[model samples]
Target chain A: MSAQDEGRPIQSSTPDGAAAIGRHAIRTEALSKDFTLHLQGGLRIPVLRDVDLAVAPGECVALAGPSGAGKSTLMRCLYGNYGAGSGHVWVRHDGRDVDITNADAREVRAVRRDTLGYVSQFLRVIPRVPTQQIVAEPLMARGVPREDAMAHAAALLSRLNLPATLHGLPPATFSGGEQQRVNLARGFAPGYPVLLLDEPTASLDAANRDVVVALIAEAKRAGTAIIGIFHDTEVRDRVADRLYEVAPLQDAA
Target chain B: MSALLTAEGLHLHFGKVAALDDVALEIHPGEVVAIVGESGSGKTTLLRVLAGMMAPQAGQVLYAGEDVHAMGEAARRRLMRSDWGFVHQNPRDGLRLRVSAGGNVGERLMAAGARHYGDIRAEATEWLKRVEIDPARIDDMPLQFSGGMQQRLQIARTLVTRPKLVFMDEPTGGLDVSVQARLLDLIRALVAELGLAVLIVTHDIAAARLLAHRMLVMRRGQVVEQGLTDRVLDDPQHPYTQLLVSSVLAA
Candidate 1:
């Protein structure tokens, strides 16, 4: 597909689309998304339409939109959690822009392992896995030794205010805030070049929320490009460089 | 990377029931693929067909670009002995219950042409430790071991040959939850440590989530859904898949 695109003249709406494609950390080209309700007689519900989003290295863009305006949908599309209805979702992985929309499973997985990281609102609890191991898994998958990964996980958990005692136990028994901290630690542990955070602070207390803000700031200074959905205005203001509004479509009722 | 094993258009019938219906999949090197479904979903049948224990009436199973069904009986058996392994749900089926733990593991090494008794025993002892079994129990018969130990022993025996691909049919089935967790963790670590490709069929979604990178949701012998494990579990698109995910009791 990229080969075919290279042969055709690059036609993009944004003046910098061609230039940004070469330099940006991550970007979308006329991206669109929708859902089909199989139970509801296959009714199609359109979400995002022609979303041309781009994030440069070291910058943070927070998605701003009303509930049901497709904010989370857009974030999932950028992270390849949701397949795009049309157009390309390009991510710079290993020094090349990979279109996540059409990339093979292995290629997408490779990009996710090294370049893209996402911290959803809730932790997908792995039964019986210790909290520290949960956070350390991404690092281990990326080839970090187990001992080093565990230490990195512990350090991040401590920074997030999760007690050391809880780190040895499964996060299934932890409070919502504690589990969220574990999720945050795991996502941020990899220091991915492009991150999609869906309300990273939604379940956190003020103190831990501040720690997250600090983590995001630290990540940004290290040349990471982050796209996030922050309901907490204070935290959003502290970490986000700008807001990208996802306006609701008018055609669907 | 090319797939270590691939099956296409697999079709089988048990009387009026379609035990396997047009099933197709590929297992790449060092990747874990789980087949998940309720009872009688033909997950075990799929595993058996893929491992060459059972043949589908239609479709082809390929190992390294060679047709599994087309291979000579001796050649296929040799492949199972050296390049592939199978872990039965019951350890008794996979292991020689009368044989000592070390002997059980050593049998595979001997089958692969190891004639030196000391070398075979040494490798078996090492594999025993790798699977978390006490090396001291190397001389103990498998019947004397606990259910979990027997399962671990079965694993050790299969892995002794360093098979590039393994087929596991409900490896953690019928064990206590705690024991199952430990075994699952051991299997996860070993798979990573050795970079072995695994095809696991299980009814346990939790086990699938813990071990498999990709999952195929089977129902009535058909692959109703398939994708990255977390994606299929977290955001199930098919109604059957949604029901399967929602039906799991919270742990």
Candidate 2:
């Protein structure tokens, strides 16, 4: 289904300018993203076109689509990891609305620290850093006392079922499942107001997957706006309050 | 079905503060019940009382239809060792940090009368794997595991005996979102598969919703609402419950 097929974008007009993103925890208005194929004679391939989405506190919105449908691209665009082609992607950060597409680097970093948390499929480990310290770095950055932060990180690792013997070792040599757990621990450590989960449970087993689902439910109840891409239908059904279809560009055409 | 556990006219006091007042409840076989309330609501006191960890000034806690308090000290200890599991809020409270991870799991098997060392070790390894820990790390001490791992190890130790009933006090408290999430899932699955009765004390309504079949919403040491978990959470009739449900959403 195309964006047009999923009912009109529910954006209300504001007197100050375009629709206010402050009205929701996360909102994107007419977001258009295109990737340039410089290798193929600069082909301007459109990824997300005129996409509008709003996620409210205590709500979960699942993005559903096939591979190569730009769902991940859209998530990156909202996180400012990928620049948009046109339109606004606004996030409520520190009690104010900041357009991710236009926000400066500092503003974007602040939002990442205080307002948003993203959990991807892989862990980005700094070689030689202890697993406990890696998870603690973010909390330390936010001014948590060093001992308290490390304790919290250790607690998080335990929850992920990572054995205690590996606490002092780096995650670089860990298995895929272990690395994924580390990444999840970090993403969930911050308790950001909005969480973006991209198959957070992809490498997890039934036990771990259930944990991720419970975590998402708790976050929603705590008033965190969550946008996640869960390929597993059962997981999506359990956690998502609504579905937002991201039709491929070819389908839109 | 017969009651697996019961409490009658429970009362306790901490100096001038009445921690519990005329509290009463029961649990049936294979039933998962949750006690939820704000801090200082005496939910924890009720859990401790039922677990026979703390003596109540007035009232009786019955396990298998007998007064748990009236039982001989050795009998109570044996009952706790063989048929009951306790998962504390802090993993450290339940785990022996000095013991090797496998030893921690093996201890329970031994309590259940597993005589052979080789068999005890194998069973410990098996339980460790069941809780998603790598069995190869069986010799590692609980002191070395992360907080989440320690909690899982504690769970393994508690459930290794396949106890008929478990008492949990905020089983997922203080852990990160994802970790707590997984633990809740583990608890739910274990409770179902083992057909074990559980009485959990938690302030998290979401935890109650996911794991409990019935819920007791307490205020000032009294249950203001009690019913099927879905009924109470979805359409709470009590004013305090309404405020709690809405406040949790707004937070």
For model 2 chain A, the run of ten residues with the poorest summed lDDT:
A1-10
The prediction achieving the highest TM-score against the true structure is: 1
Tens-place lDDT digits, model 1, residues A1-253: 2212211121222223445475589999899887766556767888888899889999999999889999988888787676677898888888667788666555677889999999998887546779999999889999999999999999999999988988999887788898899999999999999988999999888899899999999999999999999999999999999999889987433
Q: What is the TM-score of each candidate against the true structure?
A: 0.89, 0.51
DockQ of 2: 0.01
Name the TM-score of chain A in model 2: 0.91
In candidate 2, stretches whose alpha carbon ends up further than 4 angstroms from where it belongs are A1-253
The residue-level lDDT of candidate 1 at B251 comes to 66
The best candidate by lDDT is 1
List residue ranges in candidate 1 displaced over 4 A: A1-20, A40-43, A163-167, A250-253
| TM-score of the second chain for every model | 0.98, 0.97
How would you encode candidate 1's per-residue C-alpha lDDT over B1-251 as one tens digit per residue? 78899899999999999999888888899999899999999999999999888989999999999999899799999998999999999999999988899999999999999999999999999999998899999999999999999999999999989999999999999999989988998888889878899999999998898788888888898888777776677656676777798889976
| lDDT of candidate model 2 versus the reference | 0.82
For every candidate, what is the interface RMSD in angstroms? 8.8, 22.8
Of the true interface contacts, each candidate retains a share of: 0.11, 0.00
Write model 2 residue lDDT over A1-253, tens digit each, in one string: 2211211121222224545555499999899988654344556788899999999998999999999999998888777666567898788876667777656433465678788888877675434558988788778768788899999999888888887899899887998989988988898887888999988888889988888888888888899999999999899999999999999999989
Query: Which pairs of residues clash in candidate 2, taking residues 3 or more apart in a chain or in different chains?
Result: A154-B147, A158-B148, A158-B149, A159-B148, A164-B144, A164-B145, A211-B181, A211-B182
